[model samples]
Target: MANIVIIGGGPAGYESAYVADSLGASVTLIDYDAPGGACVHYDCVPSKAFIASSEVVSNTRHADDLGIRMPSPDEITVDAPQVYNRVKELARAQLADVTAGLAKTKVTVVRGRGRLLATEEHGSHPVEITPEGEPAYTVEADVVLLATGASPRVLPGAEPDGERILNWRQVYDLPELPSKLIIIGSGVTGAEFANAYTEMGVEVTLIASRDRVLPHEDGDAARLLEDSFTRRGMTILTHGRAKTVQNTGDGVRVELADGRVIEGSHCLMTVGSVPNTTDLGIEEAGVEVDDGGFIKVDRVSRTSVSGVYAAGDVTGVLMLASVAAMQGRIAMWHALGEAVAPLQLKTVSSNIFTHPEIATVGIGEKTIDDRDMDVRSVTMPLRTNARAKMAELDDGFVKLYARPTTGVVIGGVVVAPHASELIMPITLAVRQRLTVQQIASTFTIYPSISGSISEAARRLIEHDDLD
Candidate 1:
């Protein structure tokens, strides 16, 4: 049996280890913290736990809109410490669950910092493990999977102080709500936090370097989200790049590149992320990295070195947790003499967890533009759906793209309540190359938001007929 040693128990590392073990390989998983990685322990699970509480605030506040009497706005209060406690509790529970699963799978879980000691021309390497509060040791492995993940990118002048100034990972420890928050960056991370805080009654100002929020998303979806944010009293600063952040006596001041200054009780730097490829001896092990320090890997997740593989954020592919897991699995399968499929990025689905989530899959507008593909698209607004009207939600739409000639679904985007769930059918349609007619013929629940997807597909067919 092949012995696999996986580094950094994030989604990439742990998932890879599990897959390798299931494939009859002896696996060792090494991570300094819990096995679930940052996604489960810090970013995804914890943030969503906080968002869940904030969502309660929003729902209670909006209950009256649905003809249900809610407590007076003045009588209602959000206990931030309680919310933060819940976030931590949930994270700990999840970490425990992941640890238990690893134990059940018989994957050896080593708690420590793992580094590559040396690599042979082919097969096996010596990995050094430095355990916290324990002696350092070494292990031999036939294959070394590097899934070290990435850390929050810190700007030169806007470093996180873990107090008034924070990054996404550090935001969970906030004991109380900020009176006024200045979020620097209008990406997915920034937008989600802005939505959560605003719902929790915090004054939020979002600074966007791009002309609009979620510049990478569908333009219509971005505009809808921006409009929703504004309606909720969020102050959005577009084309404003943060030049520096200075800690004031009581708060902080953010200076924009254009000489504009914004002050707030707290500042969140949602800038970006850097791969955790430093000092782990990646280069010394004969692995090649890109200019940005992300390890270079092929579709099969193979690095330049024969026995070394890289996955997840370290490879700079799609940074979604799901994609990371897939990459890890592919790496293990390809390394072993097993059936494997190279990563197909086009089949990946991504979601932004805001008030009204944005989920998408397959080719997008930019892809269409760049490829100059002959396709047609139709959008159906959620307001037209009976369920949305009943739920008093009118801030989303479903958009589908299809080949005009074959009517095959190529891509889709959903912006609605639980858009992440609503996009799955469209995702299957795209991945399986289902035609618009096939999707339209499928049964949809009456008066449901997902019906909009089929309605959009039908509209595309009608548009095609006109041409």
Candidate 2:
């Protein structure tokens, strides 16, 4: 059996460990934290738990609109402490579940920080492991997979003190919801927290360096989200760039480059992330990294050096946990000499978990326009959908793209409540190369938001037929 050493316990690490063990390899998984990595412990799981609570609060506040009148909808308030407690509980439970699952496997889990020692002459690599409060040791491996994840990028002047000024991870430690929150960087992380907190009754001010929030997402979806945020009483300052942030003992103050000062009870910096590859000895091991310090790997997850592979956020492919897991599995399959296909980024589906979630798959409008691809597209508004009307959700849409000549489904975008759930069929269609006619012919339940997907597909077919 090949001896494999996988570093980083996040989605990429643990998922690959399972794959390597299943392939009858001796796998040793090393991580400084628990099995689930930052996604489970700090970023994705905890934040989504909080968002779920905020959604409940929002539903209660809007109960009267649905004719489910409560005694006092206006007085509905979020129990911040209870909500945070549940978030922590959920994260811990998930971590325990992952640990239990891994226990059944032959994979050896180690709690330590791992770095590549050097590439040996005998085609074996040595990894130096340093466990917390313990001495350092070395493990020899036939193959080394680097799944070390990324960390939140901190600004020079806006360092997170874990009190008034915070990063995405530090918000969980907050004692209570801030009275007023100022969010810097209007990217996905910034927009999500701003949306959740605004729904939870905190005054939210979002600072965007670009012309609009979610500058990287679908333009139509971003505009609709911005409108929804505005309706929910959130302040959006477009073209506003944070020069510096100062925590004034009790609150935080932000100075904008355009000569504006904003003050809030708390500040969240959602600038970006940096890969955790600095101290991993990638340089010493002859693993190549990009200009941004991210590991440079082929689609098969193979690094520059033979017998060395990289995956997940460290590879800088897609930062989503699902992508990380996929990359990790690919790395193991390739290493174990199993039948494996190169990672197809075009078929990857991703979701932004906002109030009205944005889910997308395959080719997008920007790519189509940039490359001048010959494609037909259709957009179906949710306002016209029966289920959306029943649910009193009026602000979202479904868009489908297809080849004008062959009618094959190339990509899709869904903007609605639980769009993440609705994007699966579209993702399947994209991955399977199903045509628009096939999607239109698929059975869909009436009075459902998913019907909009088929409707959009049907419209694409009609347009193609006309052409």
Candidate 3:
């Protein structure tokens, strides 16, 4: 049996450790925190927990409009501390469940910071981790999986003081929500927080360097998001270049490159992320890192080093929780010399947790623009869908892009309630390259949100308009 040492407790490390342990490999999972990794402990789970509460509060405010009467409090109250506690409780419980399962396997979860040390005078290097207690325990194994996640990007001038200006990860501890929030970046994370907080009654201003929100998404989808955000009272400044953020006595003032200034109670720097690769001894271990320090990996998740492998955000390939999990699994199979499939991002589904949440898969306008592929798209507004009208939701639609000749779907987008769920069928179709006729033929529930998906596909078949 091969002994596998998985570093970092993030999704990539924990998932691969679980997989390797199940495959009868002795696994040692090393990290400073518990097994749930960043996604569960700090990122995905906890944030979603907060979002759930905020969503409830916002939806309740709109209950009467839904023909449902909600009990009205003279002055609605928000117990932020209690809400935060619940978020932590949910995150902790989920982590405990994952840790419990690792017990039966020969998987050891060690708490420490690991480094790759020079091997003995005769062999390859081994991972050296300094345990957090007296007389640290050192465990060495043959295979090493690197899943150290990424950290929120802190710009040169705009460092997260953790007070006035903060990263998305630090917002969970905020006792009082921002009265007016200025999110400095119109990326996925930026838009998500803007939408979520705005729904929770925060006055949100989305500052973007690009012309519109979600510049990387389909043009129609981007336009829709921009329109929706504007309708929701979001102050969107296109071509906005935030220079410096100064903490004012009352709030914070952001100086733009164009001499324009804006102020807000709080600022979220959703700029980007930097892979956590420094000081891990990655370079010393012979692993090739990109100029930006992200570990260089192939489609199969193999780094330059043979015995060592890297996955997830560290690889810098589409930093999503789902992508991280898949990379982890692929790294293990390839390392173990078992059957493994190369990473196929063509089918990877992504979602922006915004107000009219945008979920997409396969390729989009960005792909078409860069690759210069001749594809046809059919964009149908949800305003025309009976289900959307009945639900009183007029803010989203389904768009499908296909290869005109073969009628095979190459990409698609969905925006609406449960858009994350609604986009799955389109993602599957794109991944499998299913024909527009195939999607149109599928039985869709009457007056359902997903019916728009069928409508979009059918339109593509009928129009034959390739733009």
lDDT of each: 0.90, 0.91, 0.83
RMSD of each: 1.4, 1.1, 2.4
lDDT of 3 by residue, 1-467 (tens): 88888888888888899889878898888888888788888778887777777677766766777899877732456677888889889999999987887776788888887877654444444777777784555556677888998889887677787788899878878878888999999988887788778777778999999888877777777888889778767899989988998878678999989999999998899998898877788767778888888999999888887778888888899998888889999988887778988999989998877767788898888879888998888788888999888867878888888987788898888988778899899988977778899999999999898999998888887864521
Pick by lDDT: 2 or 3, better one: 2
Residue pair clashes in candidate 2: none
Task: State how far residue 385 of model 3 sits from its true place (Å).
Answer: 1.5
Write the residue-wise lDDT of candidate 2 on 50-77 in tens digits. Answer: 9998888877877888999785745777
Q: Record all residue pairs in model 3 with backbone atoms less than 3 Å apart, i.e. clashing.
A: none
Q: Deviation in angstroms for 329 in model 1?
A: 0.9
Q: If candidate 1 were superposed on the true structure by all CA atoms, what would the RMSD be?
A: 1.4
Residue by residue across 323-417, what tens digits does model 1's lDDT show?
99999999999999789988988889899989899999999998899889888999898999999999999899999999877898989999997
Q: Could you tell me every candidate's TM-score relative to the true structure?
A: 0.97, 0.98, 0.94
**lDDT of candidate 3 vs native?**
0.83
Stretches of model 3 off by over 4 angstroms after superposition: 69-77, 119-123, 136-139, 464-467
Select the stronger candidate by TM-score from 1 and 3.
1
Summing lDDT over every window of 10 consecutive residues in candidate 1, give the lowest-scoring window: 458-467
Best by lDDT: 2
Highest-scoring model, TM-score: 2
How does model 1 fare in lDDT?
A: 0.90
